[model samples]
Target: MSDYDVIVLGGGPGGYIAAERLGHAGRKVLLVEADALGGTCLNVGCIPTKALLNAAKTYEHAKHGSNLGIHTSDISVDWTELQKWKAQTVTTLVKGVGFAEKKAGVTVVKGYGTFDGPGRVTVRFDADGASGSGPAQRAESYTGDHVILATGSVPVMPPIPGAKDNPHVVDSTGMLAVDAIPPRLAVIGGGVIGLEFASLFATLGSEVTVVEMLPEIVPFMDAELAPMLRKALGNVAFKLSCTVTAIDGGSVKYTTADGSAEAVEADVVLMAVGRRPAVQGWGAESSGLEVSGKGVAVDDRMRTNLPNVWAIGDVTGRSLLAHAAYRMGEVAAANILDPEAHRRGEVMRWGTIPWAVYSIPEAAGIGLTEAQARAKGGNVQTVTVPGAMSGRFVAENGVKAPGAAKLVYDGDTLQVLGLHVVGSYASEMVWGASVVLETELTITDLRQVVFPHPTVSELIREAAWAAKA
Candidate 1:
């Protein structure tokens, strides 16, 4: 009676990963996507933004290479050529996903999918919409033993006046596809999306201004490191504890914490506020899946209240991270293929996950911060070490780039509770710290572990040693 073993309603990381796993297991799978295969991450969010950031970093490095004993002349950026390269880079990755789905023997469907009761899904093909490389699928009804709702998210465009119908206003997607860099840019939020763009544009000679409603940018990160990162990004102007009132043409008006009204005039206004799960506009209301204030309610195994229905990624609003989605997909699929997964302890939880913010000097951390540790009323010893102590950081970033690493450990148990780092290559280094936190390793245990010299990762070991003091 079922059309397939599983029906995936998205093509994002969570959806595709589930489909791939399901397909490879010899279960019939149908992956329905309305747009590109790789979702926001590959087509718009992570891949393109990182490409731009890398390009900006390269330019910034060349501009300041005199201290490193290297010099170049006539440094510039051809925006059109850069965009072309970005497009090609995205295209290649998308094709790779297509090949992956094909190799997994999954049936690819291109259309808008919505819930059609408990175990059924109705996919509606856009009458005249452009389709991705996947075969165009007509309106079809699909019933499955299990359904994965991995619809991902959409930018939270808050109701600010003139935000819509304005040429200067842009979201994260539009920000990435800018035809030309504006001289002055106003970013509304100071979260990951806002700050990342702020870092990208400021490096490329844009006068960037970040207005954050929170007391500090990257509120989810270690509080101490947040201010340090702001200071490191000296070029970009930051107005913290500010709330935007509206978006006027080419300008953003905000209210400071002190009730002072201020407006920033810019060529472009970026609404980098946040993202909400893409759960609306679908037939979910008609379905029996329980929707909560958070998002679609799902258990650790990603099962919904409705039988045979599951949700993952941003749609569930569990973590709203791509990596989290991947894990959620894994848990959801394992349960789908083998319903006894929960009995076998096959479940996903947010355990010591690594978090990263790619500013000029990137910031990444895992586990409890010092403040978080102290809040728990435990005796904690925390050490903040300069990344420059690592020979690689000194040689690569030089003395001017302020980079620091912190290790938070329990004074009683000697267990490492957290690791936070802000500097060059922080993103690349946080996962190693996550392992220490996950394993709950102690200072003595870390000391026994040898680290290669001249690498910034050595700073972790250095901090471990210092935490002893």
Candidate 2:
């Protein structure tokens, strides 16, 4: 068996980044993947979906350009062309990541790896039987001093009747690969994935309806941001506090808030409930690791109970985000090299991590929400502003709907407790506040800094000033 100093299983953002970092640190590393190099984010989940969403947005703009005093006619979307473009974009980026792996001197092994013991892995290649290179026909094993598990998650398909058999039923991956837009689309669940698809299809000229079991969409985000997103996607229908009982043919049956059952007919039904970690076939039992509802249990340094074995990314299930997984990879790598180094150092804080929902007029925030701050028994202060005040908003001169910037402050320390933005490019602006929140910058420190006029970022400064410490 080939051996190395480090072995990273699953070449997602977490795995590849850890491999690259270890290789650059002058350690012999092997990066293994079951599928493409870039994993879900690039292959299906984030990157390709964003490209499609952008295309949908462009189509919307072209269709409504006349409203903005820019006259245009005969607006049409060639979905085949759009899909082609999106695939090309994804291919370029995935190839770039492979190139980077070579440049970093990390060996890229393409196969499914399962933990055989504390410091050993058995890799089996996936099946492609045309040229006698089928999965069962080709297999390999490698041992390492350290092993990092970064296998990501898969979509959760609830046990609703006819869900698996119906051709109209689809998951997030299926939704991403649709060749053409359906006339009527029924999206099940109102979490991030559901809303994002609703926004994309609504913009792409599909009659979209989102049925959510919860009382609100994106229940995890601050309540204030939810209303803004709802208002932005006015064309989409929302059925909150509703439960899907079953699906048959192209009809979805659900119970509304009033305890009455109803059915909606649609060309497509997207099951966007959530995703779970891929831990079934990885031989967790043999490795003596514990699995819980969340995922594999690990300490702060991402080390499993077993020695020289670590887990990160969706497999660890701390946070499902790609960036969070990347950070966990770093922690796991550090702990592997020198456990004492991590043990003697400060632990990374999960909160204050920036999160964004890439729907129309994206929603993003960092730090605490106003309600969260108040719930923690702080004398909370807040300030909000409409996006119209920003020069960039004026330049676009789009219909001024409702958008706001909120700043939550601690009355005693005069420090920023939270910052939330719900408007165009809110994700981009949150980075500025993230720095402030991460560093625990006081309001007085913000005051001394000069903000360039007429930029959307200035709104953050204005919101900070309005907090009045």
| RMSD in Å for all candidates | 2.3, 2.2
Quote model 1's TM-score.
0.96
Model 2 quality (TM-score): 0.95
Evaluate all candidate structures by whole-model CA lDDT and list the values in order: 0.87, 0.84
The residue-by-residue lDDT of candidate 2 on 177-248, one tens digit each, is: 786999999999988889889999888889999999998888877787787888787989998899999999
Residue pairs clashing, model 1: none
Where is the poorest 10-residue window by lDDT in model 2? 126-135
Per-residue CA lDDT of model 1 for 292-390, tens digit only, reads 767898988998998889998889988888888888888898998888988876687576778888878799888888888999987888998897789
TM-score per candidate: 0.96, 0.95
**Which stretches of model 2 miss by more than 4 angstroms?**
126-135, 343-347, 397-399
Q: Give residue 296's lDDT in candidate 2 (0 to 100).
A: 85
CA deviation > 4 Å runs, candidate 1? 128-138, 343-345
